[model samples]
Target chain A: MTIKGVLFDLDDTLYDSTTFVDRARKEAIKMMIDAGLNATEEEAYNILQRIIKQKGSNYGHHFDDLVKAIEGQYNPKIVTMGIITYHNVKFALLRPYPDTIKTLIELKKMRLKLGVVTDGITVKQWEKLIRLGIADFFDEVVTSEEYGLGKPNIEFYRYALKKMNLKGEEVVYVGDRMDNDIIPASKVGMHTIRILRGKYKDMKGKCKYEVKSLREVVDIVKKLIEEGV
Target chain B: MTIKGVLFDLDDTLYDSTTFVDRARKEAIKMMIDAGLNATEEEAYNILQRIIKQKGSNYGHHFDDLVKAIEGQYNPKIVTMGIITYHNVKFALLRPYPDTIKTLIELKKMRLKLGVVTDGITVKQWEKLIRLGIADFFDEVVTSEEYGLGKPNIEFYRYALKKMNLKGEEVVYVGDRMDNDIIPASKVGMHTIRILRGKYKDMKGKCKYEVKSLREVVDIVKKLIEEGV
Candidate 1:
């Protein structure tokens, strides 16, 4: 079927989310040591990685836990230093991939509808869109908070399709996560292109279509349309 | 007294540091809420600012302190989520002002030796220079860590001058800070241009040259050469 719209994931799919955050965190850990956190940069970072693993990245207080683990007590001073430094460096480095906007523009020029199917708080995700200066490029944005569901939910993919007023077979879904974005949307009868990014950069996915950058999605769309895939 | 070099202060002077940071933090707070934190967006944000104030931005764990103050426990989930989300949004929004590169290019084309005199750890400051893609434009970058002296230390300014092999009268010091940068560099006989940015914006200074952007420094440099100001 010919594609009528291109649905996408926001974070790693649209940008180099992991690299910048990883750099910001590593920098913040260095600051924590300078501020008397009682651990080497490597030591602190390892601890942080463990904490993120156990509690999840969505958990709020990695540094606080890090200081207590290293210092054997709750120390606000060390924790605050780590966070503030983390903040300064993190926001200072945030930016989308160079080809992100160009890819969006290219998709729009083909008269294809562009929509975002992301798993985040509605307003927070919207803030990312606005701050990245890409909100105007999308014809639709469906977030987990608004849909009362999240990625991996087949109906959530369907919700985006419904919002775009296109059938699943006529839309192509692009995302970084195979389990979250690709699988569910594939099951929904939409074409799936897993855009390899961040941790998934080298992984061989089960999907028929995989791209290294958002820019490659353009060629895939053209092929899919010509071949009626 | 003709200008032979331009020395810069990093951060807001070379880029729009504050706005991106503020937006990143706000977006992070929204993520904190989605991760099951208490407090409205405004309330959480107000508390975050207060913690940043009391602990200073360099203190590593503002989010942890925030959770304890509001929830009365050292909760790691909310804090880690806050930090991660803060980090994601923060680095995603980090960028140099639109005119930063162009301004630096203009100064370089004039054959003026460009240098950076900034406070902070030497390597960290250098990382910023490298990431901003302006490190190559600078002939020298003297950080507080390298000089064993921080801002407001007149000797550090002198140190930069010594490295450049230019007399203070023949170089212009451009910084966002009146007290740390302009006053100290001016005392060493350099023509000082206060680049008003972030909190320094709109604040009147005693220096004869005040600029709202690095772009204006080019004109001032040309004017200083022609008039020997």
Candidate 2:
């Protein structure tokens, strides 16, 4: 029952993307409106949601596809407008939770294998990770963009396990989503931890293990390993 | 397939509690710091999450419990500080979505019965409905707090159907949770339409039928009523 590998979710879990994306949303909406499109801030969000349904969060690809989708009915100028606004938003606004760096440092010192399994746009996630300075802590990073699957998809979990060269039972997957992260990881035979600090903090009753802070995870894993469960 | 009654979720679908609660969180954390309990905003939030988990969101009853849980461990002064800040953060900010009132009006005009099935404290949710001015639209309202059961549990849905005096197949249940709303209702012979505007907007799957906006619900019900489905 010893955990030989650990998988972390990138967005909100590693880097606080809620604050990061709030700025991105505002800029993106202004660009859409200023470019003579009839879309409001709310409509831009609806468009983003539609894009996610179609493109699975690869912002590099989604950006162009969103413009084309809008251009199918509206003026094409909004595309450039959106691109410029997206670029002007600083990535430095992305902040890791206060304990994240210290916890990751402790996890690294423990010599456990580290992995990042996330549903995020390739360029955006990488940029944010690098900015947060914890990118180097991960031995393997699997993204929905690269792997062609998202969380709650068993195949994605399988792909991460394969890449890490670890059995499902040897890995502990931690994330903020109950259905997407905890349930599917547990279903795949990994010990799942629901982090009660991020977007899904208020969500209840879906994970095998729960922790309020990342620091607690190290102790929980040690206890589990000692108990052989 | 004529629709006899409609059921709705109370939290984010009919009332916008997400924004209100978010504002409350900001105020609560700031109060904790101002009361000298925490040095930074993140620490305050950490304490808040701890308090929420230990207390369980039980209609301000948990507020006292939250203070007791954190009392000797942290600063006792912060206990009294977060209460008024939590209340003033405005539960009333929750308003019916724009098409909500109009759609309910049209459904009322059609003479079909109406009801609500929600998962929350009844006092909190019913007050929400009344504040939002949609209380008059419901023939009967049921909450998990009243039954000690939450959805995906068919008993709660069954309770609502019995109160409305309608057979399962004679009513249409509209809600945003797929597993809870569409799946359970369909199992009990009720027609289900998955609303795409709220929590389930990002979810992918086939339900009985899917519609993007609340305005579309009126049309769906009208068609089924006309065809006598």
Q: For every model in order, what is the iRMS? A: 12.6, 20.1
Q: Candidate 2 residues A1-229, lDDT tens each?
A: 5789889987777767766666775786676676566666777677877886776545445545665566564222355456545644744366788989998988888899999988865444655665577766888878786788787799999999999999999988888888788888888899888887655788767565788888888988787788887
Per-candidate alpha-carbon RMSD to the true structure: 14.8, 22.7
Candidates' lDDT values, in order?
0.82, 0.73
- lDDT per residue (tens digit) for residues B1-229 in model 2: 4678877776666656666776887787686566555347775566656766776655454434444445545322344455546655664355788888998999899888988988876655665665577876988888887789978899988888898899888898888778778888888888888877654577766786787777888888888788888
Clashing pairs in 2: B1-B228, B1-B229, B2-B229
Given candidate 2, what's the lDDT at residue B108?
A: 92
Looking at model 1, residue A137 earns an lDDT score of 86
User: Which CAPRI category fits model 1?
Assistant: incorrect
Predicted model with the maximum TM-score: 1
Task: Report lDDT (Cα) of residue B112, candidate 1.
Answer: 96
Across B1-229, the per-residue lDDT of candidate 1 in tens digits comes to: 5889999988788876778778888888897788677889999999999999998765777988888888888654456567767766756766777778999899989999999998876545655665566777888888786788888999999999998999999999888888888899999999999887887776656778887777898999999899975
